[model samples]
Target chain A: MPRTRPNLLERQRRRLVVPFLLPALLLYALFMLYPAFTTFYVALTEWNGVSAPEWVGVDNFTRLTDDSLFSSTITNTIVFTVLGALVLFPGAMFFGYVTQRLPLGRLYRFLILAPVALSVTTAALLWKFLADPNFGAVQKVLRAVGLDSLASVELLGRPNTAMLMVVLATVWHGIGLWMMFFAAAAERVPAELKEAATLDGASSFQVFRHVVWPLMWEVTRTLLILWMIQGLQTFAFIIAMTNGGPLRATEVIGTYLYKVAFASSEFGYAAAIAVVLFAAILVLTLLSQRLTRRESEQY
Target chain B: MNRRSLLRATAVATAVMLSLTACITSSDDGDEPETESSGGGDASGAPAEITGDLEVVSFYPEGSPDFERLSGLAEAFEAQHDGVDVTLTFGGGQDVPQIEARWRADDPPDVNYGFLDVTLPDGGPWVAAGDTMNLQPAMEQPLEGYDGTWEEAILPGVRPLISVGDDIYGAPESVTTLQFFYNEAIFDELGIEVPETFDDLIAAADTIKAAGIAPFTVTGTFLPYMQVYWDYLALRHFGLDGLQQAIAGEAELASLPGAQEAAADLEALVADGNFLDGFRGVDFTSAQMSFFQGDAAMILMGSWLIGEMAAAIPADFQTGTFAFPTVDGGSGDQDGLFGGTNAQVVAAKGQNPDAAEAWLQFIADPANQTAYVESTGGISAYTGIPAPEGFEDVTAMLEEGAAFAPSYMGVLALSQEVQTAYQQPIAQLFFGEIDGATMLTQMSEGLQAAAG
Candidate 1:
């Protein structure tokens, strides 16, 4: 059969689409796409922000192999992401489950989410004060309990404990958001299905394992990816608390990029680091989505 | 739906377009009125009679004492110059990053209050590209009231602080001398004398430590404050020139016997627990508070410390300062001091270069310099200006031929990359995670990598 021409309304709608989409498309290209392409170009040069940019194709990428600081930054980012996911995923889910069953569930949720309201900088500063070796409340309590040795340890100073402190601070501030996500997912589960599981003599854990867990896989996968991206981009708290010290122990790729660009005036090298970070996040996100994807199921 | 409605719509659209065009053209014209002359200043070596905005950006935040003094200086300049409006912008101690962003945007301020040091990559790029105006010719001219030239009015050692080779890039405004400030009561109570040699300093520190007080306290988190120890040690070990040469990568820092020994000495201090507990985690304010609270017996700080900690300092607490002790078996000048100068530079690409230069000269004049010193408790960078009443002792110390040696990180004689690479390793060395030899190796490798 011969192809039919579009109706009058369809033609008008098609013509109208350009006028409506033009502004958004132009904005995206100017702000996002333009900078991204410029970053790729900048990654291949030795521009110091002020002087003329000198082209050095692939030199920055090659230098990464010999750049111990960059390597350490990558290692730090990976460790943070993996450890953060391991802690936050189970912790948020468990808290969400327990709080949902409590008599004062709303109060519990409110209490848990209070920290999320505080800005990241404020939370980091509060934690820094609390971890102070000399006059912190934590140290005072530890000393009172006769754990003088533990009290004497400087959590934010030593390389061994600095990253751990930063991780703890990050989790404390972030756990609430993930918990709220899981709680919302739990609220959406069918009560009848839960009752049926209960009637089948399933314990709370077993019901969650068999029914709720399967249903919430989508939310859990999204949370995991979000946490991974955030962990990779962690910088503000580390900067406020440790400043990538003592001895670059907490130096993630984000902080390292900042140092390279602003502190060292190596804009090209910094752009290369940014590109690598973006690539890693993209690959990891794709892999995660592929792995977590499931066939549609009836509940 | 007749032709009349369509005609009305077109008339409204046309009216809007015409009004918008009128607004744009009027605003543009209002912003830049035609000038009678394009020259920067008139005759008699004064800033030209120009009517325009002169914007100044500074690191001194509004609440700071320096901020008020700077504002007053700008006001005085505005008062003297007719038809010139001056606006001051404060960066709250983040001037480097703020200035960097503005400079990259190609819209830097008319006058920038900053250090001219090239070691840490703060303003070095602009200086190297000649983005800042050369002030040599301006300096040769005499101030309004001062009979002598601006160059002659500046203190002997201050001009070099803001100069790269023979070209002066900025006018030196204030000076700060780093010294070992001690609680006089603690020294008197412990029956300890002011140390004059490295050995004597160590003995004094030991006595303080034995008394269950920290010998010295420093803000290790900031890193630069802790670098003072390394700077003094290097200076006392190898002379000033030798240290500069090492920083410039002309010589290996580790190869210098003095450098090696200095590293070892610093490590020894760490091993002996001479610093406050958890000093590495403390910031500058807290470290100063620890000193003021008498938790530490001594603190190595700049002259600005007296003013910064004025409120916290006890009324009965007497503070005494001494030059960094000379190292035994060292070839450096015993009286050399580590410190920095506060200078102001004019943006070459700014609209009012002559107004900026005049403002600098106004600030550098003997009368304004004295007022600034009095207000901020900072040492003046001008000669023949009597020291502020509270800082007479420091003035005397400076007068005793205590040569000025800029901090290694201050003038950025070394690239920022090299400095950053050394920062973590140096902290590790301080924490005993790495030995002196490891630190030296790391420094050498980092410098080599930067060079490559």
Candidate 2:
């Protein structure tokens, strides 16, 4: 006889796996994959999401070049991304080291991640209250300390200051998650390398600069890529807090896209804006991935 | 691994299936079942007894005290109606796109809030596409108890907004107009008389500035404050109809002499340093509080500010209201009041159109209108309804010279794209970043693009 077929029990077990996996796969396909693909398709059309779409054939893309707001938003996104990378990357690495090495390290780490657990909405509201020009807690404190002008100035009402405040708030709220990641990565660094550096009379700083950083580069590069992508998608903080106001000083690509899509109902224009942001992030992510590969290969 | 385990697995699987089945089945019949009774003896006698569950939607934002009162009213209505239940859904704030989307959906809300500018550029498509009900029949029907407000004394300018070529769409809920709310104490301290003309306003600003207080306070948050400049100047220069004509596309903004003067007048206000430094960053809440804290002497705000101003100030805080200062020698005589009313209309496709109409009739009563006005700090559109308590001083200003001109700018003719486009240019004017003529040019171009 040919190879004996599996028993009914085995056959039934194999069939059981399909049913178990199918629902989750089907849900993912329906909710995530389908919508994402449709969004891509819509991006290429001149549709307002109300009536039937007109085929503009990249006219939206052409229009975006001359649009002052689009260009400004792109600039803001780059600025926000750079600022986040500079602050979050090194700041997290430093904090992770300090928490791991310093006294009361556990308590400090707990405090650091507190904001991370707090919703961005809550954080935005809290900071807005603090930054209020009239009766904010921050203003009151600053006034008591003889910094009356700073207290009186509407921090989020001005242009450059509003942009700065947005970046500062975002960095503060986001640094904790990166710190947590760095701490874990730092902990996983070979104890042998650390001990070897110590035997050679290397100071803590030197040990970190030479051994720890290289080992953690893999993790940092990975995180940097993720943060870069997240940074481009920044919306809630700017929208909830600033609303891209005081003459569009703080309008980011994400917020600009949202205003065009939902507020103005110019879905096609918004899609074009989104495609530009998506392309930028995609390029940055791929470039970072390549850099990470080269760095990993060196070891 | 074994038959015993297999049996347990099937048992668990069957339990999961049963639980899911129960959830799906239960959810499918969430709405209460209505037993239709035919032509029974009812007071409003029509065909079938009105009994059904309704899913209603409106653009009223959640945190308002009015929303809670309305919800309470719905519950009371349900209790009185016996078998009828109403479920309400609220809409987004500061944006109407979400509300419009619901209107265009396959199953729209039973009712919705429509902007007075029903014939917007982008809106034309939807109206043409049949997203909205014609509403002529419902609007023209003499709302039983609403006759007093609906008939005579309704603001003349406001009537046009509710009608399109003689077909009424909605009724008014509240009427608002621009007025100067001033701190009498500050005026007394500075020995400055309240301004009666644009020149006087400029002079008062100088006097107030000399007294070490900001002359004017305007909210930088909402577009209303920025638009007030245009409104005040337009009325003072060419009048409401002149601006209305420009907004209605009857007159080109670039060619209108009144439009030019209005722009120039606003430019003067910015050049005079009447507002606080970087006032563009200062939001409405802050601007409002600034007056209460005695940081500013006067604010150009709507009648709604009368209540808000009273609530924010000290218990004994005294404030006064006056009509916006007229340009003494303007080209046109325009009334300086900006006011309109909101009407509730039933959707044509609504399952319980009659019931919705019934609710509208109930609320249309002056007795109910008074209660709503009291709860919401709004003026009942009904002429017979007396103004609420503590609205005395403001009402006096209204009695003196209140002309009800509905907001007919972006909402009336401009698209959402054009509305947003105006925001930046208008903001720039407030900051002395752009002149009025340039602003008007940009607005005209934006409108033309929308037209295309």
Candidate 3:
């Protein structure tokens, strides 16, 4: 049989499809694609965003090696990202499990979700009041008990302590969102599967491990990728709390990028850093997807 | 083609094109008209009646005292000149981020306030590009009751910063200077006199530390405490010209004896644990609270601290400013308190140049200067303007063989990048990890890179 091709009417209909799609495609191209392309292009030019750009080729990227704050920012970002993953992932899973088991699940959900509703800036400011070294409630209670010697300690001044404080703030602020995601995932686990685990006389922990955890791996992995991306972009809290100071101890790559771009007016250098960061994010996401696919295939 | 279908198609196409044209034309209207008026007096030099829209942009936001004063001035100018309308836009913080954004926008503010730097790192030299307007012609002519020449009016040493090669780039409005604000209760309890020399300062620190009180509370987080070290050292070792030369890439940081000595002294201070524990972790508000609560004996900060202290501390707590103590055998002059009067300048492209000039003249007047000083407890920069009554004695003391020295003024004459670069290494020196020699070498390299 000869292959039958589309007749005139069908071919004309196919042509009409492009016109219908053109407006949306044009918008996406203008807003999203253009900026992405321009960011990479600008990365190669020494433009302060003030005057005409001077083409500097790879100078911006080369300068990153010599940049004093580059290593520090990368280290800060990695530390914060790892800590965010470690603390939030396990804690969220546990909270989701507990909330599902609790008698008043609604109350538990509300309590857990309350912090997520607060803005990062507002939360940091509130924490500043709580952690304030001198006049804070914690210090007041300490001083009242003849613990006046501790009154002089600058909790926010010590680099490690400050980093810890930021981690704590971030984890607390982030817990609810991840918990909700995990809780929904765990809730969707088939009732028959859980019943079978129980019928086998599996312990409570055993059921969670064998029945619930396996079912929720996909959701957990998805949340982890999302959190990792967010963690890499973490900046507002540091800016509001520290502005990457105390000797640039809190200067993560995001804040450093902002500084290089806006503060120093080194748009080309900033663009290079931004592109590198974007590429890093893309690679991590793809790796995450690949892992999930492999795990699902095994099942 | 059917006649009716062709007509419908043409109508639809026309409608689409019309909508597109409407969108494009509307955006064109959004382009703010650029105004470039070099305001001048009438032939007789009498005040000219201004009659146009005056556009002003400030880095300071609404409700800040500086913003309030500026806006109030704008309103008053608008009312006085019926034909002039003043439009205001608020922008960036006292940081580089805001300036870059404003500079990049197609419609730059006619009256824009910027840091006293000549150029940004990526932006070519401001003077070379003529990006910034020269204020020399306007600044040269003085208004009535201004009394003194521009040089006579401003603190003598500060002229170098505002004047680039031959032009005045920025008119200083508010000068932020670092001063030692000691807790009176802590000092009194420790039985330590206010320190007059480096030895005295060390001895006082020891006494406070022995008493179990932190000797000093500082926000080293982001080099908050570094300013004191730099300003104090500059006062002792570099002198204004030497500091200026180092900042300009004309002199190497290593060549300056004061830089090494200051760096060494900072290292010593850190090693002795003279600062608040975890000082590097501390932010400004926390460190300030420590000082207010008498947990520390002293804090080094700016004149604006008075406003903060007034809000934070109890009514009865005593707070004051004093000279940074001199180093033993150091060349620093103790009397030179580091700060100067900042002047306000009208941007050349300002729409309401006449109205802007009126506000500038009003603020620069001696009477208004006194009012501004008294209201804010700031020093008067205008010649013949009396210092706020109680502050006169202290002002005279700071003025005695003392010059106004802004911490970053020298670095400012170069570019903002060099200025920000020096802050961190100096901060590292405070951390005691890096020595002064390394810092100086880094500073020279950083400055040279910025120049290139």
Q: For model 2, how does the per-residue alpha-carbon lDDT over B311-363 read when each residue is reduced to its tens digit?
A: 46786566777667778668766444665556554554455655655565556
Native contacts recovered, in order, as a fraction for each? 0.40, 0.30, 0.49
**Runs with alpha carbons beyond 4 Å of true place in candidate 1:** A1-8, B1-44, B50-52, B68-86, B92-95, B114-123, B388-403, B409-417, B445-450
lDDT, candidate 2, equals: 0.68
Q: With candidate 3 superimposed using the best TM-score fit, by how many Å does residue A158's alpha carbon deviate from the native?
A: 2.7
> Which segments of model 2 are wrong by more than 4 Å?
A1-20, A44-48, A297-299, B1-49, B55-63, B94-101, B119-126, B147-157, B188-193, B239-261, B306-313, B349-351, B388-408, B411-421, B432-452
The model with the greater TM-score, 1 or 3, is: 1
Report, to 2 decimal places, the DockQ of model 2. 0.30
Candidate with maximal TM-score:
1
C-alpha lDDT of residue B21 in model 3: 46
Winner by lDDT between candidate 2 and candidate 1: 1
DockQ of each: 0.27, 0.30, 0.37
